[model samples]
Target: WLIKNYDYDLIKFLQWTCATPMKLIGKQLTIIDEQDMICLENDYSQCQPSQNSSIIK
Candidate 1:
């Protein structure tokens, strides 16, 4: 939804996802964008939980 709604690049998104800090709450994942203007939230009910929780940008 972030990529589609914000027109974010795939490579950049992947890199950002790799480097940026994130927060997880149960099945929800939250991360700030590079511009620091948006917060992306993803549901990971079908996947494993993430390990890192650093703030982005």
Candidate 2:
């Protein structure tokens, strides 16, 4: 529900992967194309529980 509504940067993320921040790959792949960036945004900032003292949102 939450993960699906965000903006996922598949290209940039994959590029970042296996490098330093993520390290998804090593010295195997030499490039990243459009297919590699299949997914994109995922903003969960709006995921907040209700504070009505009755039920959780």
Candidate 3:
């Protein structure tokens, strides 16, 4: 619907959908609150391995 109505690129839209943390109820996607978004960002940032880490390299 969004693609047809707004002429959005399918790949970009899917990429955005995957990158943003949101609730998927059926076919509808709901936005996460600011607090949840901040928490998710912090969680991912803390878990990232350093570039110099042997495990990643």
Candidate of highest TM-score: 1
TM-score of structure candidate 2: 0.22
lDDT of 3 by residue, 1-57 (tens): 554666334534443344443332233323433333333544544343333435444
Residue pairs in candidate 3 whose N, alpha carbon or C atoms collide under 3 angstroms: none
Query: Considering every candidate listed, which one attains the maximal lDDT?
Result: 1
Query: TM-score per candidate, in order?
Result: 0.23, 0.22, 0.22
Q: Model 1 reaches what TM-score against the true structure?
A: 0.23
Candidate 3 weakest ten by summed lDDT: 24-33
Cα lDDT tens digits, model 2, 1-57, are 323764445435533442322222342343644354343344223223333336548
Q: How far does residue 29 in candidate 2 sit from its true spot (Å)?
A: 8.1
Model 1 residue pairs with clashes: 21-54, 21-55, 22-54
Regarding lDDT, does 2 or 3 come out ahead? 3
Q: Which 10 consecutive residues of model 2 have the lowest summed lDDT?
A: 18-27
Off by over 4 Å in 3: 1-8, 21-57
Q: Please give, for residues 1-57, the per-residue lDDT of candidate 1 as tens digits.
A: 656666555545564455333332232223444454233454233233345765699
Clashing pairs counted in every model: 3, 12, 0
Ranking of candidates on lDDT, top first:
1, 3, 2
In model 1, where do residues sit more than 4 Å from their true spots?
A: 1-8, 21-57
Q: What is the C-alpha local distance difference test score of each model?
A: 0.44, 0.38, 0.40
